[model samples]
Target: MACLACLLALAFVAAEAQQMQSNISQGSSLTPTTNSTWLSRSGLYAFGFYRQGNGYAVGIFLAGIPEETVVWTANRDDPPFSNNATLRFTGDGLALPTAEGQNYLVKPSSTPSYASMLDSGNFVLYNSSREIVWQSFDHPTDTLLPGQRLLSGNELFSAKSEADHSTGIFRLKMQNDGNLVQYPVDTPDTRPYAFYSSSTSGAGENVTLNFGADGHLYLLNRNGTNIRNITEGGLPTDEGKLYLMRIDVGGIFRLYSHDLKKNANWSVQWESSNDKCDPKGLCGLNSYCVSIDLQPDCRCLPRFEYVNQGNQTSGCERNFVADACKNRNENFTYTMEELESTTWEDVSYMNLRLSDRNDCIQGCLEDCNCEAALFDGTNCRKQRLPLRYGRRDTGTSDRALIKVGVPRKPDTDPRIVQPGNKKKGRTGILIIGLSFTAFGSILLLISVIVWWKHNVWAYKRMSAVNGDLELNEGVALRRYAYEELEEMTNNFKEELGRGASSTVYKGLILGTQKPVAVKRLEKVAAEGETEFQTEIRVIGRTHHKNLVRLLGYCLDGAKKLLVYEYMSNGSLADVLFTRERQPFWEERMGIARNIARGFLYLHEECDAQIIHCDIKPQNILLDEFMCPKISDFGLAKLLKADQTRTTTGIRGTKGYVAPEWHRKMPITVKADVYSFGIVLLEIICCRRNVDWSLPEEEAILDELAYNNYHTSR
Candidate 1:
C-alpha cells in the first residue's frame, strides 16, 4: 500500500508540472467586459484584465490566493481603459488597442511566436527559436517572486497605497555598485538621501538582488557568488509554501510568505525598519515631526500658526509681525517668551558670551534683527527671521527666547478738541473728506493691479517649472543660485569629507560670514522632479534641537547641494574614540539621554515617523556646548502612519545592527531601541562596539555587558 501511494504522488506531481507550462498562440486575447483570463498550469497565477479605477488594467495576479493579489502590472502609470479595450498577443507584441491608440505593454526585440503565464508568476513572450523575447520579470513594478532577481540599475517602486496600484513615493533600487538602496521617489539618489542600503558595495559589479526558491532573499554577484544574505535564514522548504519580496505602500521593503493549505493568508516574514519617521523630510518647513501612539503628527512652534491646517505637513508661519526696529518709543512693546528644554538651527548671526540669562534677554530685546535667542547657560546666540528645526526635548539645556509684540492699551482720554470757528471747521472737514475719498479710490486701484500682477507672475513661475520645484507656501527656504554657492564655498576650496554619495565643504554665508557646511550631492535622480522638491520641503519643515538643521538648498540643473549649520565640535566618534580622556560618567549619561530624546522626537514627536537605522557615534555630531545632534540620514527608514513594521535589505554598520536584522522577523522601532542600547553600552565603556585588540570575551561590548549581567546575577 505504501509503494502504491508513493507512485500515485509522483504521477500527481508530474501532471501538475506538465499543466504549469501551457502555450498560447498569437491570436490569443483577453477582454475586461467578459472577465477573461489566461491561467497557469496549476491555476496558481493568471494574466488578465483586472478592475482598476473607473476602467480596467492588464496585469498578473495570484489566482489561487483568495484575495487575488496583483504581483505585476503593465503600464501601471497609464490611465485605465474601458471594457471595449482588448489585450492581444500578436506579431507586434502584447498590445492593448483602444479607441485612442495602440498601447503596447511590452515591445519585444524580436517577434514572438507564443506567450505563456508561468507558474512562477512570470509572463513571457517567446521567439520562433524558443528563446525569451520579453518577460514580465525583466520589467518588475513592485514585487519580486521566488527565483527572480532585481538586476543592477533596476528599481522596484511601491504602490501608491494598499488600495491603489499606481506608483508611490518610495522606491528600492539595485544599484550598479553592488548595493541595494531604498529612497523616496523623486529624491536624489545620493547616500545622504537613502533610507536603507545593503552596504554590499565593492562586492563586485553587476550584483543582483535575488529571491530564492527556498525563500532566501539576498544579493548575488556577477561571478555567481552569494555576496550578501539579506535575511539571516530561509523559511522551511515546503512545496505548499510561496514567497515574494515587495516594496510596500509604507515605503518599506518586505518579504511575505503564504501557505496554501494552512491559514491561506499572506504574512510578513521579514521587514527593513519599523520607525516611519526614519525617512527625512516627512514634515514641511518650520515644523517638527512627532509620533502620537506610533502615528506621525506635525506641530507648529510657539507663536506660530499652521500654513495649511488641513495638511499639517504644509508647515507653519509667524502669527505676529516683527516691527522691533520700527521705533523704540512706539506703542509696540517687545517681550521675550521663554521655551524651556527647546533647541533649533544654530544659525545665529550674533553670539554674546554672557553668564547671566537676563543679559541675554536684554541683548535680544535691544537688537532689531534678533527674532529669537538661544541661551545655553554661558552663551546667548541671537537668531534672525525664519527659525528652523525647533523641537521640544528634555535632554538639552538650551532654552529658546521668542521676541513677541505686546498689545498697546487704548487711550484713556476720549474728549475731542473744540474748533475755534464753526463755519471754518465745517468747510475744512468737507474739503478733507473729498480729498480722502479721491485718495482711497486711487489706492484701491493700485492694490487691484498689484494683486493681478502677483497672481500672473506666480502662475507663470509654476508653469515654467511644471510645478516640480515649487515648495509649500509655509516653506521659507532660501533658493541660492549656483553662482551664489560657488562664492559661498570659495570655489569649493575647503574639503570636509567625501563620502560615497556626497562631498562636504566648509563654506561661509555670503554677507553674514557665518560658517556653514555645504554638501554637494554626487548624483541626482531627476526622474521624480516633483518628488525631489517635495522631499526638500519636508526636510526644510523639520526643526529639532537634537536633529541637524537644513538651512537651505540649491537646485542648479544637475548640481544638487544642501546647506547646514556648522557643528564646531565635530562628531561624537572623534570625542569618544580619538580623545585620550573619555567623557565623565554624568556627561555620558546626559549624552545617552540626549540621543534617546532625539530618537523620541524623530519617532514620536514628528508628524512623519523616522527610524535611524544606522545609529553610531560617527553619525552623531556635537554642538559648541557638547550637545549631541543626530546626523547622517543615509540609512534611515520610514513607515506609514498605521504601519509599525517593515522589511527590507539589511542596513547599518555591522556591529550596531539589531538582532532582528539577522533574524527572519518583521523589524519595528524596537530595532532602533536595540541599536540605542548598544550605543549606551559603548558610551559606558568608552570604546567601539567591536575591538579585536581587546580580550576575546570583552571584544564585543554588548556581549561583554550580557556576560557581566549574568555573572553578577
Candidate 2:
C-alpha cells in the first residue's frame, strides 16, 4: 500500500510539472483583464500582465507569495493601459500596443516560434531549434534575484514604493569606467555623488554585477576576474535559501535573503552603506539629516521651519526676513547659533582662508548672501540660504554658524509722543489716560505677585511628591543640572570612550564622591529626543546586577546627558581585543553566563519585555570584580506580552546583526540569541567574529563553526 501511494504522488508531481512547462504558441495573447498567466515548470515563477497603478505591467512574479514580488518587467517605464492592452505572441515577435495605437514589437531573429517562463524567473523567446532569442533577464527592473547577471550598460531603477510601481529616483548600474555604482537619478549630472561604488580604480570595461546563488553579490571583469565582493560576507550554504539584491527607493542598495525551509520572510543580510544620512538630497535643501537611533530624521536650522509643514524633505523657510542687500540696513544685527560637527560640502557661497574662528564668523556676518558658515578650525566656507547636504559628521572638528535675525523692538507709538509741542485738548486727554493706566498697573502688579507665589508653592509641592516616589521599585533617580554635570566631569577632560550616539567622560559625583560615567549625546532630531526619553525611562525602571544602573540625567537644551555608575574595568572589547593579556578561560565562561542572565532578565523578567537591539562587546561593561553588565539601551525596544515580534528598521553593528534584521522578517528575541551565539564563539576563540587577518575560510567564526559541525558529523 505504501509503495502504491508513493508511486501515485510521483505521478501527480510529474503531471503538474508537465502542465506548467507547456509552451505558448504564436498568435496567443495574455492580458490583465482576462487574468491570464504562464507558470514555470517548477511552479515557482509566473509571467503575466500585472496591475501597476492605473496601467498594466508585463512582468515575472513569484507564484505563491501573498504580496507580488516582481523580478523582471518588460515595459516598466511604459506600462500599458489596464483593460485596453494585450501581450500578443506573433510570428514577427512579441508585440505590445503603445498609447498612440502603434504596435511596439520585440523582434527576435528567424521568426520567433514560442515563449516560456523558466523556473529561474527568466522569460525567454525560443526559435525552432529551441535556442534562446531574447530573455527578460537581459533587461531587469529593480530587483536582481540569484543567478541573475547585470551586464555593462544595463541599469536597474528602483520603484517609487510598494504601492506605486513607477520608476523612482535611484539607479544602480555598472559604469563604463569599470565601477558598479548606485546613485540618485535626480542629481544634475551623471557624476556619482553620495553613491556606493565597487572600486576607485578604473580596472577595465565590460564589468558585470552578479547575484550568486550562495548569497554573494560579485563584481566581475570581462575576463571573469573577480573584481570585488560588493557584499563581503559569508554565504548561506542552505539550498532552500533564496537571495536577491535590490536598490530601494531610499537610495540604498540592500541584499536580502529568505529561508524556504523555515518559512521565514526576507531579511536584510547586507547593505552598501549603514549611515542613514549618507543619501544625497535626503532632506532636500537647507535642512540637516541626523540618525536618531539608526533612523534618519530631518530638521531645519535655527530660525527656520519646514517650507511645507507636512513634508520635511521640502526643506525649510526662514521665520524672519533677512536684511536686504540693496537696502543695506546697518542697524540689523544678526544672532549666530553654533552647530557642532555639521557640514555643507558642495553648497558653499564662498571659501576663505581665515586665520581665526572670529575672522570666519565676521566674514559670514559681512556677506549679505551668507546664511551659514562652516569652519574646520582653518578655512571658512560661507553657505547661501538653501544649504544642501547638511549633515552631522562626528569624526570631524567642523562647526557651523547659522545666521538668525535678532528681534527688533516694537516701534514707539507715534501718536503717544510729540517732538516739539502738544495741543491743549490732547494734553488734558493724555493726563487722564496716564492716571487710569497707573491705577491699572498697580492692580496688575498685585495679581502677578499672587500668581508667582502660587506657582512657587505648586513647584515645591510637586518636587516633594516626586522625591518620595522612586523611579522604579528600588532605584532613585536625580535630575541633575547641566552646569552641575559639567563641574563634575571637570569640563569633560577625562575622556573614556566614544560611540555613534554619544561620548563618555569619567566624573566624580559630588557629596558622595563616587565615580560615574557621563554620556553626552550628540545633537539629534526630534526622534532622537524621544529615544533619549525611552532610554532614561527604561533604565530608570529596571534594577538588576547584570544591567547598568542609571543614576541621573540632564535634559538641557541641545545637551542630553546620562549619568551611570562607572565600570572600573572598562568595556569587554578593551579586555578582549585591545589589551595584550587574554582573559582566563573560567572568566570568559562566567562572563558569557552573566550576559545570558542579563538578556534573560530583560526579555522575560522585566516589567515589560525589552529587546536590546544592539548587543556587542563594546556595550558589555565589566566592573572591578569582573562582573559583566549590559549597557547602552539607546536602541532598546519594549514590547507587550502578547506580541511575539515587531517590525523595525535595521539596527546593531554589521557583524552582530542577525539574519532576520535584513530579511524584513518580524524581529523577535531570537535576534539577540543569534548575536549571543556569535559572541560566545568569539569569546572561546579569543578573536573577533569577522577578523580579516585570518584565512578566508576561517575569517567568519559562525561559518567556521557551521563547517566544523557538519564536517564532524
Candidate 3:
C-alpha cells in the first residue's frame, strides 16, 4: 500500500512538470496553465519550455508573431536531463530544476528572486529585493535585441564561431587598460580594431551616429581628424532573430531570428563614440594630434613625430615658444597650419564673433595671458588658459586665433568732430532706408509675379482644358491628377501629419517638378459628401501668407484632397512634441509671439474675421525661413464683421481645447489664448500636454506655464 501511494505521488508530479512555463527556476515557480493564452502579459513576449535537439530548454518568445520565435534563453547552455522540467519565480528570482530532482539542473541561489519578461524582450532575473541579479543581456549567446545593451567594460566578451554555437574569436568589451575595444577574441592582441574612442585629435575630430525614431541608422566616423561616412544602411534581420544583432561564440556576428512586423522587431540605436585622435587638447599636454586616412576610408590621428611622430596614442608638441611676455612688443602670433584634436582638458571655452576678429587679435596681443581668441559669426570668444588652441567638433564652436604674445596701445592722435556730420548721417540714413524699402518691395513684387505665373495663369489655362473645378476668387491653385499625387507621395508614403479633421503628406506638386505638402481627409468618416463640401466651401475662400496657401484640391466622388504650399520645415508639433530637435529657446518664444501675432491677424487684420477653432501646434507649420504658418482651416469659423466672438462646437485637440468649450460657452479669442498657452508650454519643455513620462513637477501644463512665465520674467 505504501509503495502504491508513492507511485501515485510521482505520477502527479511528473504530469505537472510537462506544461511548466520554463524548464528552469531561480526561486519562483510558474505553472503551465492554459488559463491565459500565450498572450498573457504585455503582449510583447511569452514564456514556455521547448523540446529541441532531443533536449528540453526554457526560453521567452515573441507573443505577437505567427510563428513561435524564441528570443531569450533561461537554460541556454544546459538543458534539463529529462522532459519533466519546470520553472518557478519566487521571492528570490527564478530557479530552473528538473522535476525528477534538483541536482540534475537546479540554479538555486542563496538569495530570493523574481523573473519577468520585459517589453524590450529581455527576460530579467532579479534577487529577493527585485534587484537585477542576472539578465539574458549579459549572456547573449548570439543576439542583440532592441533595448539590450552590451556592457563594454574592461573586457571584450566574445561569442562562438560562425555557423556554430560554440565559442568564437570576436570580443566586444573594454580593454584591460580602460579603452573600449571591439576585437576578434581568438585573434592575437597584435591586430585588434577600434571602432571609436573618447580620445581624438586635430582635423580627425569628426564622428557621430544618429538613429532615427523610425529605425533609420547612420554612422559618421573620423578619418584621422576629419569625419568619414561609415555605414550605408542600418542593422539587418535574419531568421527569427529579427530585432537583435548577436555575436555568438563563433567569430561571426549574426542577426538572430525575429518577425519584422512584430513589436519585438524594434530598431535600437547605439551611442556614438570618438577616437582619442578627434578632439583638440584631449591629452591636456601642450601638443596636438594630426591624423590621416587609409584606403577603403580607414585612418588614424597624428601623434608625436620625432619622439613618436604621427602616432595617435602620443600627441604632438611644439619645439618653439614666442618671445617672453616681458619683451611683449617683440611677440608675434603664428598659425599652426594645423588643427588641434584631442579630448578636452584644462581648456577655456569661448564664443567669438567673426566681426570681432580684429578686436580679438588685438585683445590677445594686449593680454599676453589670452592664449586663444576665437571669432565666429558676430561674436568673440577668448580663452585665457595656456592649453587653449584649435577647433571643436561641437556645432556651437566658432573660428578662433591663437596668440603667442601681448599687445600694445596705438601711437596715433585723435581728431575733432566734423560740422557736416548731420548732413552725412542723414544721407547715409536715407540710402539705408531706401535700400531696405526697395528690397522689401522687390521681394513682394517677385512673390506676386511668381504667384501669378505658376498658380493664376496655370489655373486659367488648365480651367480651359479641364472642368473638374473652378475658383471664383483669384487664389491660384495647381491641379493634380491622382497619378501625379501618387507619384509625388511615392504612393502615400505614410502620413507625415494628422489633425482632428485632416491628414497631411510629404509629397511633390506634379506641375512644377517641385515638392509640396498635400492634405486629404482621413478615409474613415470623411467618406460622406456633407463632410467634404463643408471643408471645401470654407477653406477654399481663405488666403493669407501666415495661413497655409491653398494650392489646388480634388473632389472626386469618393476622394477628397487639398494641396498646399510645402513647408520644408514641418509642423510645430514635430518640433515641440516629437523626437525632432527642439527649436532654440528664443525661437520657441518667438513662435509664441508669432502665433499671437498670427492670431491677431486672423481675428482682426483679415478682410473677414476668421475664428481658428483649433489653435494647437499641429496646425502650425514652420516655413523655410522658420516662420509660423497657420493651417487646417477645416475647423475654422468665419465671424460676422460686427461680432467679436461666436458660439462654436467643441473642437480642437483634447488637452488644448478650452474648458469653457466643453460647457457650450461662447468661443472667444480667450479660448485660443488658453490653447496657445498650452502650445507654448509644450514648446518650452518639448513634451506633449498630458504626457505621463514627464516628472510630476513638469507633467502639469498649467503649472509649467506659470513657472516658465515667472522664470522668464
Candidate 4:
C-alpha cells in the first residue's frame, strides 16, 4: 500500500508538470522593464528584450539560470531599442514596434495564432492548427543551442566584441559542398583563404552541423549518417546544465557549458583551433602576426611603422619614401633586411633561379623595380608594394628580404680643411655658395615658367584629342601602347570571342604569367573611339567584385583595345548551351544572384548611375570559380547625378533589347531591368531566348514560361 501511494504521487507530479506548458495568446506582449519575458515551461529559456550596449535588444536568453546568457538575437545588426519598444505576439507574428519602425522578430509564412517558448531553447510561432509557421532556431545569431542545426550555406558570424552583439570580423560558413570553413569577414570563401575547415568536402548533400545535448558537435549527412565528429560526446547532461557552441570575438569557434547550480561563469569545453594567430588578416597589409606566450600580436615589417598606434591590425606603412624604385639610380643605396621564419602570400611579378644566395640578393639589388625578394636558397622572387597575408611560422624555409633605402651620410672631413684655417675658409665658402644659389634660383624660375606654358598647351591639345579620357590610379588602370598590346597578345593570334564591336584575344601580362583578355575594337575609325571613351570613363571609375576589372586600355592612333582580367570559365552562354552536363541548380542560382548584384551596384549603388545597354548571357562572363562578372561596357550609358533617363539608339542584342528602346521613348534604368528579366528567364530554363530547335509553342523562352505559368494556374 505504501509503494502504490508513492507511484500515484509521482504520476500526479508528472501530470502537473505536463500541464505547465502554456501557450502565449496573440495579444500577449513583452517590454524591457515590465512583463519582460515569455519563458519555457521549465523556465529554462525566455524570449524577450535584453540589455545590449546602451539600450535593449530583442533576443532569447536563459531565464532559469542565475547568469543570463543570450543565445539568439533578432536582426543582430540593427540598432538597439529604447524602453518604449514593445515585442508583441500579434496575428502577423512576433513584432517589435519601436519608434523607428515595426520590426518582425520572426516573419511567419502563415498567420500566427499563438507562440511558445520551448524548453529546448527554441522560440516558436504556430498557426490555428498548431503547425509551426516560424521559429528562432531557423535564424541563429552567434550561438547554437542543443537540438539546433546549421544547414549548408548558412553562416554564423562572431560578435564584434564581448559586449557588442553586432556582426564582427570573422565568419563560420557551412559551405554548399559539405565543408565547414571559417574565414575573415569580407574575404572570399575560397579554400586557400580559409583559416579553419572541417575537411569534409565530399560529404553527401544535406549535410548539417549539429551540437548534441551530450556536447557532441558534429556533421551529419543526408541519410542520418555521421560524417565527422568535431568534438567527442563526453559531458554531463544533468538538470540545470546547458551547452552552446559559438564563434567567439577572437575568431575561435568554441563550445561552452554552464551549470546553473554553481551559478558561475561559462566554461570552455572545446575550441576549433589552438593557435591564436591562425586567422588571416589578424594583421592587415604590410604587417605580420606573431605569437607571444600563445597570444596574437601584430608587428610591422622592417622599416615600416604602424598605421594606427593603438590598433596594430590596421597594418603598417613605410616610414621612408616608397618611390625609391621609381627614382632609382646606380649610386642609390638599398639594404635588404632579412626576416627569418616568415612567410607571406607570394604574389611575385618576376622570379629567377640563381646559383647562390649572394646572387639572389645581388640580383634584387640591381633590379630597380624590385621592392622585395623571397629566397628559398635556389629561387629568388621579386615583389612590389603592399604585401599581404604575412605571418611568422618557425617551420618555413623561405626567407624574406625587404628592400629599404639607406640615406646618404653627409661628407664632413676635418682633414680637408686645416683646423686653424677652417673658420677663415667658412666665410669665403658661404659667400660663394650664396652667389651660386641666387644664380641657380633665377635660372630655375625661368625654366619653370617655360615648362608650365608648354605643359598647358600640350594639356589642351591632349584633352581635345582624348576627350576626357582619364583613368584612376587607385584602380591601377594603366594605358598600354599599341606595341605593348601586340607583345602581350602574341600578335593577336589566339581569339577567344568576337562581338559586333570588338574581338577578345587571350594575352599574358609581360613579366608575370598572368592571363588577360585583350578586347580590340574593330570599328575604331567610325565610332569605336566613342565606345573606348565610354568604357574608360565608366569601367575605370567603378570597382566591384561582380564587374570585370578594367586593368588598362590602349589607344595608339586608332588601335583601340581594353585589357581585362581573363575569364577562365568563359561566358554564361557557353555554360548554358555548349556544355553536355548542365550546371548544378545551386550554381545557376548563384550566377543569377551575382548578375543581379552587379546590376544593382551599377544602377543604384554607384556614385553616378550606369545602364548596361546590353544584358545577355553572352555579356555575363564567368571567372575561374564560375562567379559571374558583367563585361563589355562598350554599349553602357552613363547618367549624371541628377539625370534619371536618357535618349539613345537601340543598342542591345536582338532578343534581349528592351521594348522602350524600339518605341523611341527615353530609356531609364528600368530598361536594364527589363533586359535582366529576359536573361533571368533564360537562366532559369537554361536555354536561349529564341531557340529554333524547340517546338513551335516553346520557341520563345519568355513567352513559353509565361504561358506555362498561366496554364499551371
Question: What is the per-residue lDDT of model 1 for residues 1-713, given as tens digits with 9 covering 90 to 100?
Answer: 99999999999989666555558889878789773678887889988888887888788999887887999988898888788888888898989876678889889999999988899999988998999999998999999999888999899999876666888768999998889999866555667568798998667789998888877898889988998999865587687988888988767788888998785889988888766554444455566656577666777766788999986546788787655344443444566888887657666644566778888887777555567888999878777766654555567899888877765446723231111111111111011111223224224323332343233212111011111222643344556777778989999999877765678899999645999988887757753343345445544544567787777788888888888888887788888886674777667667766776677556654444667788888778888988898876655665565656788778788888878899857876667766766676666567898999999998987777666555644
Best-to-worst order by TM-score is 4, 2, 1, 3
Q: Report residue 405 deviation for candidate 1 (angstroms).
A: 9.7
User: Going through the candidates in order, what is the number of backbone clashes in each?
Assistant: 30, 6, 101, 0
Candidate 3: tens digits of C-alpha lDDT, residues 538-560 = 45544444667666666665667
Candidate topping lDDT: 4
Worst 10 residues of 3 by lDDT: 457-466
lDDT of 2 at 155: 83
Superposed by TM-score, candidate 3 places the C-alpha of residue 210 at a distance from the truth, in angstroms, of 62
Model 2 residue 522 lDDT score: 83
- Per-residue C-alpha lDDT of model 2 across residues 1-713, encoded as one tens digit per residue: 99999999999989766668747788888777774678887667898877778777777888755546777766566745567678788887777766776464466766778988877778888999999888778877888887789988788888867655568767887877787777766442235364567763487888888887777888888899998888764677565767778887677889987777777788899988998788776686778988899998998888888989876667998887675432443334565788898766544524565658877776666555567888888667766567777787788789888878654346733343121112222111011121223234224323332343233212111011112212232233566778788889999999999997789999998745789999988857776676677777677666567899887888888889999999999998888886475687667767877887687667655546678898889999999999999998888886764555799999889899989899999887777767766776666667788988889998987787766655645
Q: The CA-based lDDT of model 1 is what?
A: 0.72
| Cα-based lDDT for every prediction | 0.72, 0.72, 0.49, 0.77
The CA lDDT at 571 in model 2 is: 90
lDDT of 1 at 459: 15
Name the runs in model 2 displaced over 4 angstroms. Answer: 1-19, 91-94, 103-111, 186-192, 232-239, 307-312, 319-323, 327-334, 404-407, 411-713
Better model by lDDT, 1 or 3? 1
Instruction: Give the 10-residue window scoring lowest on summed lDDT in candidate 2.
Output: 459-468
